[model samples]
Target: MLLKGKTAIVTGASRGIGKAIALGLAREGAQVVLAARSAVSREGGLEGSIQETAASVEALGGQALPVQCDVTQEESVQAMVQAALAAFGTVDILVNNAGVAFFYPITETPLKRWETVLRVNLTGAFLCARAVLPAMIARKKGSIINISSLAADERDAGTVPTGVAYGVAKAGLDRFTYGLAVEVGQFNIAVNGLKPKEPVDTEGMRFWTKPEERQGWVSADKMVKCALFLAAQDASGVTGTVSTDEELSLWHGL
Candidate 1:
C-alpha cells in the first residue's frame, strides 16, 4: 500500500502499459482516474476502454473515475483535471502515458503524419502538465511521470524500427521532463521521464509489429515497481532525469 490515501491520474489508460499502471496503483490503495479517448473499441480494432479499466479497478475495491480525454486538446485536459479534483479532492500523482508512434523514414512520412505524431507525443504532454500544475503547486507535493521511449535516442536503437518524427518528438519530451522537473521542484513536485528498457509487449505494439519480431519484449505489468517508486518521489528524492525501467529497478532495489 505504498500509495494508500493517494489519488492518481493516468492518461491513455484504456489498455497496455497505461491500464497496467492504473491497476497497479489501485492495488496499492490509490484511487485512480482513468483517462482515454476511446470509450469503446474502434473500427481499427483498438481494444479496451476507460470504462473497462475503471471496472477492473472497482473490482479490486478501489475508487476509480473514467474520463474520456483527448490530451492533445487543452480544453479536454483541463476538464479531465477538474473532474479528478472533484472526485478525489486532489491529485497526488500524474502519469502522462498517452502517445502515438510512427515507424517510417522521413522521406516516406507525410507532413500530416509527422504533425500528428509530434502533436500527440509532445504537445499533449505539455497540455496535461500545464493542466495539473496549479493544483500540485498549491498542495506543495506531487509526482509527475512522463512515459518516454527508447525512440528518444533512435540512433542507438538499431534493433528497433524508428521514425524520424517520433524520435524527434520523444527527444523533445525528454527535455520537457527535465525542464518541468526543474520548474516544479521548488514547489515540492517531482517530475521525471521513464522508458521501457526493452520493447513492451503492449496491445498497440502487438498490432503494429509482426509477431516474430517481439522475441525479447516484456509484459506491461513489469512497469509497476518503477512507476510506484517514481510516484512516491519529490525534489528531495530522485527527479529531473530520464531512466529506463531496468535502471530504476536496480536503483530502487525492487
Candidate 2:
C-alpha cells in the first residue's frame, strides 16, 4: 500500500482524470477526499458522485470523504480544507485536477472567457495550494500535484489553437509548481506537474478534442497510475518536475 494511512484531497474529482486519480489513491490505501463543485450523478460525466467514490473506497478497505468546493473561491477552498482535516485529521496529499479549457482565436477571444479560464485553472490551483500549505508545513510532509496538458507545450498543427486560455493557465501552473516546490522544499512538501498527451480519452478530452484525434492520446488510467506513484511516501524526494503518463509508466515499469 503506497499510501497506507494517508489522506488525499483531489479536486475536480467528479469525473475523468480527476475521478480516476481519486480511485487510484484510495486503492493504494489513502483516505481520499473527493472535492468538486457538486455531487456526481448517473446522468453526469462522472462515473459516480463523491459518495460513490467514497463507497468504492470503503469497499476497498480504505476511507473516503466527499467535499463540495469551488476552487476559484478562497472561502470555499478554505472550508473544504477544514472539512478534510476534520474528517481525516490531516491532509498529506493534494491534487489540483479541476480545470476548464476554451477555444478561440487570440484576436477574437473575449476577456470574460479568458478570465473564467484563468480563474478556474490557475487561480483555483493557487487557492487550493494556499489552503493546504499551513497544515502540510505544520506536519513537515506533503505532496501537491498539478494536472497540466500538452497544449502547454505545442499547438495542434493547423488547428486554430484550441486552448489559448487553458494553455496560458497551465503554463502559469507549471511555473507555480516549480516556485512552490522551491519555497516549500525545506518543509518537505513536494510539488510537481503532470501533463497528458493530446487527444486523451477522458470525458473532458472528448469534449475538447476532435473525434478523429481521440485515438491518438493516452488513457486516464495511465495518468492515474502515475499520480498514485507520486502520492506514495516513497516519492518524498521527488519534486519540482513535470511528468507525462508514458514517461512515468516507462520509468516505473508499469
Candidate 1 local Cα displacement, residue 245, angstroms: 0.3
Q: Tens-digit lDDT track for model 1 on 1-254? A: 89999999999999999999999999999999999999776777788999999999999999899999999888999999999999888999999998888888789999999999998889999998898889899999999999988888867645667887988999999999999998999999999999998888888787768878889988876577789889989888999989999988888787
**How large an RMSD does model 1 have?**
1.1
lDDT of 1: 0.90
Give the worst 10-residue stretch by lDDT in candidate 1: 154-163
Q: Tell me, by TM-score, which candidate is best.
A: 1
Steric collisions counted per model? 0, 0
Residues 1-254 of candidate 2 have per-residue lDDT tens digits of 88889999999887778888998998888889998876757564534467766677688787889998889999999999999999989999999999888877777778998998999989999999999999999999999999987667666742324657878898899889889999999898989898774455666656666677655565677788789877763236778888787787787786
Candidate models: Cα lDDT each: 0.90, 0.82
lDDT of 2 at 19: 81
